[model samples]
Target: MSWLVTGGAGYIGAHVVRAFQAKGIDTVVVDDLSSGRRSFLTDDERFVQGSILDGRLLEDAFEKFHVQGVVHLAGFKYAGVSVKRPLHTYQQNVAGTSMLLAAMEAKGVDRIVFSSSAAVYGTPDVDLVTETTPKHPESPYGESKLIGEWLLADQARATGLRHTSLRYFNVVGSGTPEVFDPSPHNLFPLVFEALLDGRTPRINGDDYPTPDGTCVRDYIHVADLAEAHVVAAQRLDAGEPIEPVYNLGSGDGVSVGEIMRAVAEVTGIAFDPEIAPRREGDPARIVASGELAARDLDWRMRHSLTEMVASAWEARRSAPVDNV
Candidate 1:
């Protein structure tokens, strides 16, 4: 039996698929190529071109691959744009999750590892966020993810579904040159794109309360995050005890100023960032403690900030001009 990874053709999803392959576990990718790239998946890997909103397609893939579990990563994942398009976000994240769960139940796939986000805790009031941090999602995307977690919990209570949701903030770096983040909204790609185009990258704000005067947020390597998903799946396979959620976070966060400096150092492009007005709802600091994940999933920051910057830059530089 194989694990079906929704959105496996996307950046983080592709890394998760590779991690499963490295552990000798078969994986089947189901993606609609909406924001994901088809070339990210290898020719040898099993792939079903479709969307999770299509329940019939999910059911068919589950049966065709003999899927034993699912890694649910397919969803509308832009917290900022979600405010302007709330309905679309709910449809893709909330309704889509409901459909996928129904398909899993029909196919007897009793295990799942959900891709959650730190957006669930909008502008957390504490210095370090934990699993118990009160959820006050500020955007539609955040609300949809929180609803997705609730859907998983509700389903688990009704059925014997074994599941866990992994929450994280900025997921950066590339495990392979074949896969690089193509997000137009992410900070790394934004800086890389600006540098490649010879435009000085801009920072949203520089007057925040952070030591560096810019906002601070957690960043984790994509490969490390991918490995944690595999371990969570293995635990479910072994019928081991697992929590309903885990935060794959860096206890301490790095400032936006620090990231800009890292980019300059890594790319040999020395230029100060242009400081713009702070975006609405921007938080000065938001970091989480991954101590729980450390004990349960062997989660740790295996890569440094320099490694994250260098690897992402190398991969982004290697991508085709049109893709960049």
Candidate 2:
């Protein structure tokens, strides 16, 4: 039986797929191509083009691929846009997850690794977040993810389903040159696009309490994040006891100012980032400790800030101009 990776054609999902394959585990991809590109996947992988919201389509994929477990990564992920698109976010993240779980139950595919978000902690009051941190999500996007985790937990208790949710912080960098982040809202992409279009990159706030006078947030490499996912899947497949949720975070975060400096250095384009006033509700620092994940999922900061900037810049440059 193969593992089914929902949204496998997307950046993080694609890296998860590769990590699974490297461990000699077969993978099947289910993506609607909403934001994901088909070119990001491999010919050797089984492809199913459909939305997880369609229960029938999910049923068909489960049977066709003999799905053993699911790596559920498909969802409406932008926390800021979720404010205006609350219904869309809930439909895609909360409802879509419900549908996927139902399909898995029908097929007896009892294992899943959910792609959750640190957004669920929404402007956490603490300096370093932990798994037990109280969830007080500020946006519909974060609420949707928190609800998704609840679905998994409820399902697990009712039907003996084995599952884990991974809470990801600012997922930056590319695992391979073949794939790049396409989100219009992400920082690295924004910086790269601005530099390529001959516009100055802007920092939303420069007077924050951070040492560099810019916002500091957890930034982990996509590759390290994906590897942790695969490791979690392996453990679940082996029926090893694992936590219900893990945060893939960098204990100490890098500042936006430092990121800008690295970007300029990596791209060989030296220019000061335009200073814009802080976006309302923007926190000075939001970092999480990955201690739980490190103990259970082989998680570690394998890439430094310099390496992340360099690799992301390389992949962004290598991607075709029309791809983004």
Best by lDDT: 1
lDDT, candidate 2, 1-324, per-residue tens: 999999999999999999999999999999999988898998777889999999999999889878999999999888899999999999999999999999999989999999999999988989999999999999999999999999999999999999999997898998889888989999999999999999999999889888989999999999999999999999999999999999888999999999999998889999999999999999999999999999999999999999999999889889987786
- Tell me the deviation in Å of residue 75 in model 1: 0.5
Please provide, for model 1 over 1-324, each residue's C-alpha lDDT reduced to its tens digit, 9 standing for 90 to 100. 999999999999999999999999999999999999988888899999998999999999999999999999999999989999999999999999999999999999999999999999988899999999999999999999999999999999999899999999999999999899999999999999898898999999999888989999999999999999999999999999999999998999999999999989999999989999999888899999999999999999999999999999999988987775
Cα lDDT computed for each candidate against the true fold: 0.95, 0.93
In candidate 2 the C-alpha lDDT for residue 275 amounts to 98
Ten residues in sequence with the least summed lDDT for candidate 2: 315-324
TM-score for candidate 1, please give it. Answer: 0.99
> For model 1, what is the error of residue 30's alpha carbon versus the real structure, in angstroms, after optimal superposition?
0.4
